[model samples]
Each structure stands twice: as structure tokens, then as C-alpha cells.
Target: MTQPKVTLVVSPRERFSYTRASLESIYANTDYPFDLVFVDVCSPESVQTYLKATSQSFKILRTDHYLSPNQARNVGLRYVLDHTDSQYVVFIENDVVVKRGWLTRLVNCAAETNASVVGPLTCIGNPAHQVIHNAGGQCYIKTDFKNGQARRRIKQSAYLTGRAVADVRDQLHRTPCDYVEFHCMLVRTDTFAMTGLLDEGMLATREHIDFCFMVAQTGGEIYNEREAVVTTDTLGLASNKAGLMARFGQLKLPDFQWSDLPYFMLRWSDRWDRASLDHLRQKWNLAEDKYFTKRYAGLGSRRHELLIQPIVQYLTFGKGSPWLEKLLISLERPFNNYWFNRYAQRFEQS
Candidate 1:
């Protein structure tokens, strides 16, 4: 059988310093041959010049549109669809430095499982003490801030209590996940032909999550290749987040009630004003299970604990909750994490 052609796509957000490092890592670590394409939306001239001059093997497409990361990705992918006869397209962020065998593993997994999307386990933060970063955890809406401060929460993992990245890497096995961050995901080109590209309107957040749902809805299973580890400083997070918030005239701070986070919740939960959850729920036939169902598990009070505060905040926007109640919430988190991690293991297996 003929090997399928592959195109590696990279669209750097802000700094090119990381882009150079990331590109070098890809060329060094990737075991298979691939056509490389870099899409830049207002990246530094030095980075562009370097890429254009350095590699005759790859092509750099630079546009001044300054589009959102998702839009920029679609733009890059549009080029891939038009120019390359690639059977597979992989998107790796400019900020990530990949590990050896990362690309091979993703490609093999996709071929083996016939997975629509397969991504490596991303390690973010300090290399020594990394977190699962963007390797899909329990997908849910985050609420419960206290006096303009964020609260600790638990996500689904094997240990069921993935407090850190090690928790994810500790038990290495392939598992079906709700979503895989696009930072380093391999997708069959036909998947796009079916579900289309990233939703350009999402701008900054939830685009990948939305894409996962789209793929899954289209009979595509998204999986994590636990053996393929990508050591990225960012756990698949969008760069220039500060600039994004600034553009919206919103400042992100520890101001207890993050005015910025709700932008993400808009796609989920009727509790939030700008929600499209009903439409999404209908689109995917989503319900209490396989969505936020895992996130609802915790130390105590699953549905009640999950919805009560969100309901209050929705009814009152951030003014309704009392400080004493906030204190109680803070005190309750340890136990909550304990229960969430313990119960969430079921979701990981599902």
C-alpha cells in the first residue's frame, strides 16, 4: 500500500522565538517525511525571513489579516487543502517544542485506530513538574470563583484526580477522550471534508473542543496516543491570550469574577447569558453523560453542587454570593477534589 502524504501545519501566534525552536524540534524529532507549511498572521519579520530562507523543503505563507488563531489555522489548512495532495494534516502550535517520535506515534495511531484525530500527551509548565497541559481532560464549564479569585478544581484521569500533569502521564495507556488539543493533532484530510475546518467565529477559545464534538458527531473517534509525548512549554494553550482579552476591552486578572472566562461558557450552559448550549446539545445530542457529566462528580452533591452556584451566578451575575458562602466553598474544595478525582475515573474509561 502507498503511504499517505502528510502536511505539517504551524501557525505561530505572537513571538517567533518559540516558532524557530518549535520548527527545529519538528525537523529533528519527526521520523517520517512531511511537507511543512507555516502560516503567520503578523508574526515577526525575522521569523518569516528565517523560515523562507532556511528551508527549501517548507513554504511559509504570511498574511497581514491578524485573524484569530482558529481563523488563522483554517487559513493555513485552506492552503493545505488547495496546494498539497496530503492525506493527513497535522497542526502544531509555534510555541510547542516536540519530543522525538511524537509525529510518528500520532500518524501510526490514526492509521491503527482509524481515528479521525490523534494527538500526543502534551506536557506543559516546567518540564520537571509538568501538567497534562492540553491533553483532553473532563470537558466542562468552570465557575466557582471567590471574591474575584479562582478556585481549585478536579478533572478526569486514570488516577481520577489529575491535580498535575504527572497524574496524566503516570499511567500510560491509549484512551478515548472528550477532546484533544489541536496543538499537535493529526487528522485525516477527509475528516475536514466531512466536518469542515475550525469554526472561525470562536476566535480564541473552545474551537478545539468544538471541533472534537464535530468529529465525534461525524463518526470520528478522537484518541490520545499515550506513548507519543510532546514536551511543550504550553500545555496546548493559545498564546497571546492577554492580547486577546485586551482587544475585547477586557482585562484578565485575579479579580475573583473573571469577565473573560464567560466568553467560553457562551457555547454551553443556559445559566450564562451568551450561551448556545441548547443548540450544541441538540447538535451533538449531548446530555448529562459524556459531556459535563464527568465534571459533575465530586466530593458531594453532583448535580446540585454543579448547577447551584452557576444558577446563582446566572441569576445575579457575580453579586449574589455572600463572602461566608465563598469561604465555605474554599474550605470545601479539598474534599471536592478528592471526590471528583475518585469518581471521574469512570468517565476516562467511558
Candidate 2:
């Protein structure tokens, strides 16, 4: 059987340690030979040297300008079709490490199921022990933020959980997913031609989701292979949080209300808008209470904790309870202490 060719694209301004390890692991573990393609998007001189040094055995191509990840990906798709006759192409990211047998598992899943797109476990942050950063696909649940703030609560992981995708018999065959993470996914070359390349407009955010959505709409299957674990470095999560807030304007809410916090904590994006700070004061009816002042009280940024305040309030207060809000205000010290004890090390390190 002809082994499937794989294309791993590395964007400019991104680190490439774990990904190199992953590719090296693939080269060592796979039973058959596979072509590796590297699409360099606005890579720096240092990165170029590293890529040339590391990827000597594989085909490497570089673009002059930075084509946002989605655009770079389309360029890669074109390269793959033109150069390789392999049956499948796997799109992977730079800062990821794959588990042993990861490639064979994904390809085997693709062969047995013939899925147009197949995704494996793409966990981020702390890897090794495999604490899930995210699995399968994700859903964005947007809510109204009262004081010129926008908030993102717990996103829906939606598809496959812990259960591994067995053989063809156990394949979901066709599962409805909002989007699959591009960090680790497989696609047939024809699928790109048939459904079209990723929507470059979405760019950094929601591009993968849009791609998977398109695939599903066009009668293709998307599967989550829990067994094929890949760990991604989430060094970009902070930037991703900033990007979401920048794209969406602030949510307007009345002052000092429980819902206000959900918006204010919009992943630290609230720092950009002075109006959001004004909203915080006007709604809470407080005197000159600044978000930054509160944020830096602890280590790192109390930003994330502050964002989830509404969720905690909801869990504690149930519904409309003026008294609960007041109680939270009074118990602020204890609450801070509890959280500090739990997360002090991470924040200090950050």
C-alpha cells in the first residue's frame, strides 16, 4: 500500500520544539515511508536555519510573506497536491508532541473509516500526564456582558470524550461537530478540492471550526480518535483570549450586578477599553474602583479568576440575590486567600 504523505505547516512567530519531536517520532514509529512537507509562513532567519537543519530529509517550502495560518494552510494544500501522490495528508502544528503510534493510529482510522477529516486528542498547557487541554472539537457559547464587557464561559467540548475510537466497527462514521482542532487532523487531498480550502477570513480564530463545519455540510465525516494523543503547546492561549475580545466589542450591563463580572472578565481583554472600566464603576456604583488595581493585588493576573466570578456567584446564589453579592464583597478576603493558596505558584511563575 502507498503510504500517506503528511504536511506540517509552521507559521512565522511561533516556536517549533515539540513539533519537531513529534515529526521525528512519526519518522521513527511509522512502519511505512511518508513524505513530510513544511510550509514556512513569514519565518525568521533563525527559524529558517532550524527548519533547514531539522527537516533536511523532508521537502521544505517557504512563502515570502506571512499568510495568516489559514492562508498558509491553503498554500500548503496546493503544494501537497502538486508534489505527492499519497492518499492522505495530515495537518499539524509546530508546538505539539505526538504519542507513540500516533501517526499509525490516525492513518489506520482514516483508512478503515475513510473519513474525510479525522482529529485526534489535541491537549495543550501541561502535557506529559495528558491532562486534556481540549479534545475533538469545541463550541463557543457567547453571552451578553452587561457593563461593556464580553465573556466566554465554559466552551462545549461537544464530541468524543475519553473513549478511544476503536476499529471501523466502532467509528462514529458521521458525527456532528462544530469544528475540529487543526493542530492534529487528517484529510484526503480530494476533500480540499471538493469542499474548498479553509476560510481565510476567520484567520486565527474559528478557522478550524469553519473547515470542519464545511466538511460536515458537504457529506463528509469527522471523527475524534481519543487514542491518538497529541500534546500542543498553548503558549498562544493568552493571545487567543486577547484576540476574541478585540474582535467582539464590549457587552453592556448595569453596574455592580452579578452578570457584570462575566463580561468584565472577558479574558483580560477588558484592559483595552477605558469604557469597560467606566462601566465597572457606573454599574457597581463603586468609587474609583479600577480593574487593574484589583487584578494586580495578587500575582500574575487575577484576571481569569475575576472573569469566573459570575459563574461562582451563580453557583452560590442561584438567582437574583442582592444579599449574595454583598456577601461576596464581604468575603472577598477569604476568597482571595483560598484561591491564592491553591494557585499561588502558577501565578507567581507567570
In candidate 1, list every pair of residues with a backbone clash: 131-165, 132-165, 148-255, 148-256, 148-257, 149-256, 160-341
**For each candidate, what TM-score against the reference?**
0.61, 0.56
lDDT tens string, model 2, 1-350? Answer: 55566554443213332344555655665554467777765355655677788876777778754445666677777777777776777787765666776677777777778788877766554424144544565654345454886543324455544333332235443343455687777887789777877765543433565577577667888776666777665433422332222114443111122322222222123222233334333432334323324532432133333333443334444343557554554565455445434443554565
Evaluated at residue 65, the lDDT of candidate 1 is: 35
Off by over 4 Å in 1: 138-170, 234-350
lDDT of each: 0.61, 0.54
Q: Best TM-score goes to which candidate?
A: 1
Candidate 2: stretches off by over 4 Å: 1-32, 137-178, 234-350
lDDT value for model 2: 0.54
